[model samples]
Target: MSLIQACVTAATTLLAVLIGGWLTVRTQDRLWRRDQERQWRDIRLNAYTDFIGAVREYVAFILNPAARITVVPRPRDPGDLMPFFDDVGSRYRERLESTKTALRLVAGRPEVVSVSAELVRQARLLAAARADSGVEALQADRFDALWEAERRFIETARADLGLPSAFVS
Candidate 1:
């Protein structure tokens, strides 16, 4: 081929290589972002589930009549009951707190964090009741408060994850 034709071919090849590289990089970057998002969603889901589970477990324990009776020697007696209450409360709180790390890592929305904090607060109240007055003192109002807090947390988490408001479970 002539020198001019050779120069034209080289220029065309160089342009094609540049365009191909750019497209490849763009596609790879998009895929990488998508993967990161999916991973974060999974982490958030696990954290929410764990936190809810911990709260529910604590509530159930306190609400059970047997647990209340066993924990409290008598309604008026305040001797030696606190140690048992403390042990149960600390164990469940630690489980819940462990999941908070994962939650803070992936929770981007403020509502999700706030609702989760409500769950923690409600759990603490239940723990305090168990500590001070025993399970007999865990009234319906307390359970209702915790239940409402849990529902709000679930709704906020679903919204943050792009799920429909009507989404159940």
Candidate 2:
């Protein structure tokens, strides 16, 4: 049309393109942030699961005599369990430690890491008790303490991951 109208149309088109580009960049940036957060949560969840699994396996091996038989040859004498305990206990402890390290690396909350330490401590206690006095010395309170520690760790990890507590009972 006229020179003024042409300039006005061109300016309006330029403004619209600039605004559209800015909105597109903003939306993409938001989406990228959300995707990164989801990936982080998944990584944390995997780490938490691995740590808990290691704890459970270690505890089960220590507390359940039958489980030990499946892992290693059963000792003829109860007193002969020392060697077995040393071997298996160290392996389990290593697994626990590695998993704990992974959890600590990914954990965003301090409580989860603290609770995991408590769980590891309880597992060690149970292993020590079993080693010193055999299964007979294994007390209900010791088992309860270990279980409670594990539960606390699970709850703390779940909260950190924004998941609802599954062990409310």
**What overall lDDT, based on C-alpha atoms, would model 1 receive against the true structure?**
0.72
For model 2, the superposed segments whose C-alpha errors exceed 4 Å read 64-85
Alpha-carbon shift of residue 8 in model 1 (angstroms): 1.6
TM-score of each: 0.77, 0.83
Instruction: Report every candidate's CA lDDT.
Output: 0.72, 0.80
What is the lDDT for 143 in model 2? 90
Across 1-169, the per-residue lDDT of candidate 1 in tens digits comes to 8999999999999999999999999999999999999988888888778877877776666665555322334345232232244455557556777776667767869888888877876766665566556566667887789888888998889888888885445
Against the true structure, candidate 2 reaches a TM-score of 0.83
Among the numbered candidates, top lDDT falls to 2
- Cα displacement (angstroms), candidate 1, residue 37, comes to 0.8
The TM-score, computed over Cα atoms with residue i paired to residue i, of candidate 1 is 0.77
- For candidate 1, which ten residues in a row score worst on lDDT? 74-83
